[model samples]
Target chain A: MTLVGLAARNVLRNKFRAALTVAGVAVAIITFLLLRTVLWAWTAAADYAAKDRVVTRHKVTFIMTLPLSYAQSVRSLPQVKASTFCNWFGGKDPKHDKEFFGSLACDTETGFTVYDDMVVPPDVLDQWKHDAQGAIVGDVIAKKMNWKVGDRVTLQTGIYPKEGDWEFRISGIYQAKSKAVDRSTFIFHWKYLNDNLPANRKDQIGWIVSRVHDPSQAAGVGVAIDKVFDEKEIQTLSQDERAFNASFLASISAVLTAINIISVVILVIMALVLGNTIAMGVRERTNEYGVLKALGFSNKHVVMFIVVEAIVIGVAGGLLGLAIGYPFIEGGLGRFLEENMGSFFPYFKIDPRMSVLAMFLAVALAAAASVIPAISAARLKTVDALKRIA
Target chain B: MDTATEKAPASHRDKAEALVSLRGIVKIYERGGEQLKILDGLDLEIAKGSYEALMGPSGSGKSTLLNLIAGLDRPTAGSIDIGGKRIDQLNESQLARWRADTIGFIFQSYNLMPVLTAVENVELPLLLTKVPSSERRQRAQTALRVVGLEDRMDHFPRQLSGGQEQRVAIARAIVNDPALIVADEPTGDLDRKSADDILGILEQLNRELGKTIVMVTHDPAAAERAKVIRRLDKGQLK
Candidate 1:
């Protein structure tokens, strides 16, 4: 038999311990993949943001508003192909009060044009344009809230307190063509929200989004738009869509950093578990190594036996981890997050590259962990090793 | 060196050349701040094609001498020549290579790889050689047959009786066709019937196959099977 074959057989000498080590490695792999998937999904919005679009918000904070005239000024820019403005409605359905989603009052004329990745059918868009009280919901939110066309829904909000709950008819459901688009949003015309507001709050907009003629020149266009508002009563801060999304992510950078650190800690734990198993196996087989040495095997051969055994356990655990992790993360948890937490984790599926990296790390770290034990076994004197009982 | 070494028949001693020769062997071990000398300056020789047994009580250095002769160990100070090569002067790796090519070892516990089958255990020594896999298997099967264990070739060491395991170990030792076989208490763990059976195989290996052997044993009955017997006491021949 080959030396490798013999070493593989030795792995089964303590079947229970081998199984436990493999299980430990598998659990670590799963935890690592879960943390990595969270980090990937969290940054996905920034990663997939449109390069050609720029957002202009109040310079001080998003809580304040800009005059509706600012939307016209942004549209008048030479580099701006189209522009849209929206105010955060902060509206929640009275029926499902606990469920959270994006609610926005957007300019009907340019909303779909600037945010082109929000796909709505022509018939539905035509119908919504004619109805002042009609609303267009995302397909995800529509399914979540059981809203269908022609259904009247009432929303309550603390920010926009009115005489009664706001009411609107469901006009259409939009599907997202890009991962950056939140699939759980509710959108209605800005004019409807404007006409219902008090005199002090009327004609005020939250933010303006403009699509540039050249994506590469988006940064220059953003500077030009902010320059237009420099002398205005309310100053504006303008950035490209990618930068806007990145700033939002930077706010929670600590959480992401913690997840990354936890991923590394899990890998270290896996290595320690693997290393301990290898050390114990080497200790138990000290006498067998002496027999091998006396039978003419070199020190290198003894090391090979130990390293090969560890490699077998490592690879087995990796395959098993992938087998369980793929479905557990992709099929079950991904679906739940996409349906419920779409605003935060719009795309929650596991990254194929991360899976490959996890498997590679399993084998590499396991071999690395076995280094001390393999060296100790190789350096053992044949006579001294033979003196040990087992 | 006086009368401690008893001479065999002159006819037997004069007919063969020396296959193993040791001069001024000294083995010292440091244990808990004290230097314990296991073997003092000693000299000995074994003729080619000889079957000799080394007998002594515990701590007599019989096993140490056998280990030195087998190249499984190095003497602190000595010149050990086996098959005309100075083994004591060779490095650890070089001695390992030399042992693979020249010496086979049998231990009291059989020392068979519990994970491997009888045939696989026999094939262990040949794995170091450039022999093709098919040839290694054939040689292993033939070795097991010589030990009368062809039917148990696929059995693991744990599945076999103590006597059968020892035979498997013997098959492993002779599988590579080494020039010398050194067995340390080969029959120590076996019953009287099993011990006799093992001794008969050792006799067959020495007589029929003409293999030279040096064995260390505490049992005189086991030593009597050899052609020549030497007694050791306090690390010196008696």
Candidate 2:
């Protein structure tokens, strides 16, 4: 038999211990994969955010509203191709109050033009425009709430208390064409909400989204738009959509950093487990190494044997981790999170690079961890080593 | 006294056609701030194709002598020339290569790798050489056959009795056809029948194959089978 084959056989010398070590490494890899996926899914919105679109919001906070006249000024910019304004409606379906989804009152005419990723039939858009009370829900939310085009639904909002519940008919359902577009939003005309609102809250918009003619000039166009309202009663902060999404991420950067650190910590823990096992194996086989040296094997051969054994264990554990992780994360948890937490994780599938990295780290770290023990074993004095029984 | 001298003793051929020779060998070990001399200024010569036994009481340095002659260790002072090469002057890496090419070792505990089968254990030494795979396997099988263990080639060490394990260890020792074989208490752990069986194999390996054998044993009965028996007391041969 070849030396490598002989070395690999040593891994099975203690079958139960080897199995447990493999399982420990697999568990660590699974944990690492899950943490990495969480970080990837959290920042997915920013990663896929439209490059050519700019968002204008209140300078202080998103909770404050800008005057509706700001939308006309933003649309008139030389770089602006189209613009739309929307306010967070904070509406909840009375039938399913436990479920969460985005609800916005947007300019129906320009909303479909600026956010072209939301694909609706031309007839449905026409129908929604004619009927002021018509509301279009995303396909994901429509399936969840069991609403159809002709069905009428009622919503309740604590922010805008009216004499009675707000009523609307489902005019259409829109499908998302891009990963950045959430598939669970419910949109209705902003004029209907303004018409019913008191005079103090009327004629106000939450934010404006503008699409630029040239994506390279979108940032410059945003600065020019914000300049127009710098001296107005309420100033605006403008940024490209990616930067706007990144601002939201900046608020929770600490949490993301923690996940990243924990992922590396799991790898370190795997190395420790592997190192301990290799050390113990080398200790028990100390006499065997002496025997090998006595039989004309060199110190390098002894070291190679130990390292090859560790690599075999690493390969077994890495394969097992991927076997369990792919189905658990990509198939089950990913679908659930995408449907339930669409705003934060629109696309929750594992990145191919994450899987490759996890496997590579498992093998590399296992090999690296064995270096100390292997060297120690190889460095033992042959005469002294043979004196001991172990 | 020159540790770096690679010259062989000039009177070696005049000393009974010696294949192994030692001149003024001294080995000292320090323990707890005390100097313990395991072997004093000792000199020895073993002829080619001779079966010799080294018998000594406990702490008499018989095993230490065996280690020096086998090239597993160097003398603290003086020279050890085996097969006309000054092994004491060789560095660790060169000694390892020399050991693979010249000396074969059989230990008391039958130190065969448990993970390998009998034939694979026998093939271990040849792995260090340029021997091709097919020839290595053929030579290992031949060695096992020479030791009358052809039927047990596929068995692991755990499956074999103490006698059979010692036989496999013997096969491994002789598989490389080394010029010198050094065995230390080779049958110490076996029963009377197994010990006799191992002794028979050693005698056959020496008389039939013309192999030079140097054995260290406490048993007088085992030493009687050798062509020459030397006793050691206080690190000096008598």
Output the number of the TM-score-best candidate: 1
Candidate 1 wrong stretches, greater than 4 Å: B1-9
For residues B1-238, what per-residue lDDT tens digits would candidate 1 score against the true structure?
Answer: 2423434677777788999999999998889999989889878888888898999899989999998999988899989999999998888899889999999888999999888999999999999999999999999999999999989999998899999999999999999999999999999999999999999999999999989999999998999999888887787777
DockQ of each two-chain model: 0.84, 0.66
Per-residue lDDT, model 1, residue B27, is 90
C-alpha RMSD for every candidate:
1.7, 3.9
**Cα displacement (Å) at residue B35, model 2:** 2.0
- Pairs that collide in candidate 1 are none
Can you tell me the CAPRI class of model 2? medium
Off by over 4 Å in 2: A121-123, B1-16
Q: lDDT per residue, candidate 1, A204-240, as tens digits?
A: 9999999999999999999999999899888999999
TM-score of 1: 0.97
TM-scores for every candidate against the unseen true structure:
0.97, 0.94
Error of 1 at A294 (Å): 1.5
